[model samples]
Target: MDAVEHFVKFYKKLDNQSLTELALLYSDNIVFVDPVRKHQGLPAMRHYFAQLLQNVSTCTFDILQVDKADPTVTVTWVMHFNHPKLKSGKTVSVDGISQLVITNNKISYQRDYYDLGSMLYEHIPLIGSFIRYLKGRLAT
Candidate 1:
């Protein structure tokens, strides 16, 4: 399989057990960015995922589509996760896209684009209601 295919596969099966396989997919000097945080290097990325997985009860990614052009790959996915402190432990689904730059058959850079409010603020109690109301108003 190609790098993009490997990446999608790795993320789909991501969990505590699959963390050790990160090195196989990401370069040593990998740079990872998302709406909430930016991390550089494999060590930093590992630390971030470790903390993230520890807090969430369960997390999974469903790759909806994958497009690649030579060194660049874009993947659309839905992330489903349940956190004890968020949304009363109910599952939250967020749609997002990941842009990856592959080098030497390993992902060297990755950036994810997603709505911060939808993934976070919308899960809060009062804030969630207000955000939803605002979104509804803007839509119509």
Candidate 2:
């Protein structure tokens, strides 16, 4: 399969058991960056994913769209996850896009763009209220 197809399949089947597939999807020198953290190398990326999976009750990605240009692929998706510490254990959906740079059929660089407030800060009680209020005021 092609890199983009492999990427979509990887995320769709992502789970603790399938994390080992990271090696198949990413290169040794892969660089991954997102709103909350940046990791370099497959080992660091694995560590990050391990911690993330450990903290959440469930996490899944629904790919909305995919655009590819040779070695680069951009995918829009909504990540649905439930965390005991966030939103009273309710599921939250975060819309985001990931840009992947594939080299030799492996991802070399991956960057994600998403709202930090929606994914984190807005889930806190008092902080969430304040942020919503501020956003409401700014929207007018």
**lDDT, candidate 1, 1-140, per-residue tens:** 66788888877866544677778888999999999888999999889889988998888899999988978999999998899988999999999999999999999999999998999999999999999999999999
Cα lDDT tens digits for candidate 2, 1-140: 87788888877756534678889889999999998878999999889889988999988889999998878899999988899999999999999999999999999999999999999999999999999999999999
TM for every model, in the order presented, reads 0.95, 0.96
Worst 10 residues of 2 by lDDT: 10-19
Off by over 4 Å in 1: none
Instruction: Report the error of model 1 at residue 57, Å.
Output: 0.7
Model 2 residue runs over 4 Å out of place are none
- For candidate 2, the clash count comes to 0
Per-residue lDDT, model 2, residue 93, is: 92
lDDT of each: 0.89, 0.90
- Estimate the overall C-alpha local distance difference test score of candidate 1: 0.89
RMSD values, in order shown = 1.1, 1.1
